[model samples]
Target: MWNGDGTVEIDGFRVYYSEVECVRRIFERHPETAVNVRPKNQLVKNAYMNNLLDLIDIACLAPQELTEEELRDAENTLLDLVGVDFELDWLKKKLDELCVKKTKMETRGDCMRELDRMIVEQRQVLLALEVELKNEENEAVSDSARLGFEDVV
Candidate 1:
């Protein structure tokens, strides 16, 4: 089933079956995966994570169905996924918490100074990303202008 917001609400087992069937169909019809358009990395990552979670569920509920090797592989893959970097919002939230902690410290020791240095460095990185995004937008606008109205349409 699909929600109004364009998100699916399917069981993990159903997801695994559906994805397997889809892959089967694709392999049967078009083995070569050459295409002009490709899914975004984020979307691919979400699907991979979903499949991994489904595997974990199966391992929990029906351990004998999967081989020990498969279980070990899945566990290692999950750990690798878990080690991915935190999202921007989460990083910002943790940074704010660190700032509060540093402020609450009574003395300006090496720990407090290191926290301050890290906070400043992270702020600089954020600012640089913002500047890069603005630069990209400006470049797009200039590219469109150079292409002329007819080409844009």
Candidate 2:
């Protein structure tokens, strides 16, 4: 029996709540249900799906703000859920990949900041050099004119 509110029931076993809440409640109430309800490796996938649904609810309720940690957790959950082969080794591999990707992204961001700083510094140096060159040219022209006047006299 479908409750039309993101919940369903079958033969008296009913999970009545939103997606995430229902799953969490069901897991809490019947730990064994985790094995029967979904593949062990896919647990993270189920959690991620629920979290995504919850995020939608959060967005509708409060669109103004969301914490970075919450967003990151959701992303991590999704990544963990993908390509699960129902094996412990596969699960560990997925986690490792996620960690590596996160580290690489952080490093790339740092490099970009350093590059920007270098560009700004270069621009300042170039401007200073241009000013110096202009001053030197002006001095040269003035000296040339003074020498010409002396020669004429």
- By TM-score, who's the top model here? 2
lDDT of 1 by residue, 5-113 (tens): 4444332112344455543443354433212223346465456546444543544444334554654565555445444421123223333444344444434566788
Cα displacement (angstroms), candidate 1, residue 76, comes to: 1.9
Which pairs clash (backbone N, Cα, C closer than 3 Å) in model 2? none
lDDT values, one for every candidate: 0.49, 0.52
lDDT tens digits, residue span 1-153, model 2:
676756554323344454435556545654543243334333354454455345334433322244446546644554443333212233334444555555667788899999999999999999999999999999998887745566888
lDDT of 2: 0.52
**What lDDT would candidate 1 get against the real structure?**
0.49
- Lowest lDDT sum, 10 consecutive residues, model 2, at 82-91
Clashing residue pairs in all predictions, respectively, total 0, 0
Compute the lDDT of residue 78 as modeled in candidate 2: 44
